[model samples]
Target: MTVLVFLDPAFADGRIVDAGKPALMATDQGATRGDGIFESMLAVDGKPRKIHRHLDRLASSAQSLELTIPEPEVWQRAIATALAAFADDGGGGAAGGGGGGAAGGAEAVVKLVVTRGVEGSSAPTAWVQVSLPPEAGRLQRENGIDVLLLDRGYDSTVAERAPWLLLGAKTLSYAVNMAALRHAHSNGADDVIFTSSDGRVLEGPTSSVLLAHAEGEGGTRVRRLITPALDSGILPGTSQSALFGAAKAAGWELGYGPLVPEDLFDADAVWLISSIRLLAPVNHIDGREIGTSDVRAALTAELNELIAAT
Candidate 1:
């Protein structure tokens, strides 16, 4: 079951609506023009993870779209109401929040959405959705996935030259992203890692690209995690940022890059990280195996532990 909570000014805790009924107007720009912003987060045992970070990104997206939304505190209250309702309705029963992945804990996916509302209405339609994450995400996290590297049709400099592209903002416009995933699926791949037209490794359709390198042996070993630079027109990954912090505290080095596919191939291991899927190891990319199975399993376990702490 899904829980819906509309952020109405008339209600201090948000207005709960029936999910089975029609709540959105047909003319809402979010539905018609994909003009809006959204953030999806993981809630474990009724507590949201990285909520502040998600809210901050939501605010940034709103600024980019020039669309006003309810304040962070308002969103927080609505999230609470939604999660409570979802649990009470039995949506949060025995299944853990790991989305059925290796993380395994009581979990729910919480989505915050705001649209331009009906044409000319001026008031944005905003709401929170609480529900179970797809089992496919969990399965991908467990068994790993095969990916295709596809050109995104834009150079890394596109974000700087075209601010209107909203490259840095997580908006409702995702037709291209979804199409890329479908293309990967049609080609016998489980997912996609988009590359810039200029050959820089960007990110996945709904995740962030991360590569790791290990040097030395035994006591002298050094492990480092790296991700593409934010200036490369990719959405900032909250999960990656949180993992980097946890990893660093555990003595793992960190770095950012203008990486290419070769970097992925050269790394000891690579993964596509996100809020819902968590950290899914990429077993192969474009038919080439990533790191050896032993190495990948080791690194994945180490990182999963760090993620659990986060």
Candidate 2:
């Protein structure tokens, strides 16, 4: 996996840099103590979809973290500049370029991460950096991904009190999140879906939940597309919103609320949605085999068409 980390001044070809760089803080540093915030967005082709929305969310998250962020326009310009430089390295120009990268046209994923700058012993520093995303390998696509239900449970009320349980914040302290993935992989699953101590579905470690139900006039016909409520404490996935709109446009009924594992087992179809992974239909959960349907394919086609049109 060839990945380039773009620093403030220019692009670099390797990992592990001199800790002397003002933007590069020490591992024992203040913000490195998991005392800050961050955000990641996909810059597909060259244009970032919902760029303003993502930036707005980032600002909200920073405010919740009691941290200040660069101005909206400034951040957007930084994102654009980093993506442009990264694409140039990929041998493509953003100009008649594909809104992003392509066959040697810079068709790569782009990510922007901003930490709480640096801190001496006393105050916040002003360092922030945006970089390109490495290509994620294709996995759990057609055949479906194996997911393990992790035993560790999160408090349902944390989102109300601390709210910054980092539930909504895309902070750098992703140790636990990454651990969940490791736990799932160790248990023979490609990912993990966190549940409450009592087994109510929360969300995938890095994706949103989508439940396919049977609808229509016919008695056992598959029906509407559903996801859990945002009030339920899941991250408000941008892709989820887009897909919901696409579903509505496709004449598919849209629903949202709580969904337990039993509900998943009972559903006609199930999928985990994300920006990069897009649609990953679940064929099996726990020990139950959920039947395959054309719903995901239809939904993906509809979404791709919607995105293309927009």
Candidate 3:
């Protein structure tokens, strides 16, 4: 059961719409030209996770596209309405207010979307969609995934040199990203890690790239988490930032990188992290295994605990 709530001025608490009916205008820019921004967040039980971060990123993306959207409070109310509707429709199983990992609770995907409204209207069409998450993401989070390194066809410094490229924004123009994923699937790979034309690691099609390093043993053990530099034309990951904070509090060292494929190959473990998928361990990259299975499992379990706490 999917729920849709439109942010309308006439309705203070947002207007719930029929998800099965045609709700959007055919001329809407989001569908016609893919001119919009969106944020996908996880909703465990009946509450959204990392909501403020998602809203902040949505605002940044709107600003980047010069698209004016509803304020955060408006979006919040609509989100509430949507979640309540989803619950009423039996989509939100039991009310477990704990973290996302809580058993016997619904784990849904909440998507916030804003599109430049009909051609010349100057108003933006916005809505909140609540639905069940894909089972494949949960499976990959547990069983891990095989990835391929694909060139993103741009240099690492492109975002800095060309601000118009909107590399940091999470816009609806995801044709290239989807195409890359399809290519990976065709090649018998489960996912993709994008590399810049200059051979620098960027990110995944829909996630962030993270690599880990561990050394020594027992009391002398040191564990470090590293991700590609934000300036390297990749979307800022809310989950990665949240996990970094939690990991740091747990004594894990953290670093940013201008990383390369060789760095990934040399790391103790690699993962693709995102809000919906959480952390998906990368078992192999370009057909080469990343670290040993035992190390990957240990690190994955450790980090999953930190995520659960969040």
- Cα displacement (angstroms), candidate 3, residue 226, comes to 0.3
38-109 in candidate 1: lDDT tens per residue?
Answer: 999998878899999999999999999999999999999999999999989876666534333555567789
List TM-score per model, in order.
0.98, 0.78, 0.97
Badly placed stretches (over 4 Å) of model 3 are: 94-104
Q: For residues 185-256, write the lDDT of model 2, one tens digit per residue.
A: 777677777776656677787788887765565454545878876755567777778777766776678888
Q: What is the lDDT of candidate 3?
A: 0.92
Ranking by TM-score: 1, 3, 2
- The CA lDDT at 227 in model 1 is 96
**Per-residue lDDT for 257 in model 2?**
64
- lDDT values, one for every candidate: 0.92, 0.59, 0.92
Off by over 4 Å in 1: 96-100
Q: Return whichever of 2 and 3 wins on TM-score.
A: 3
lDDT for predicted candidate 1 compared with the true structure: 0.92
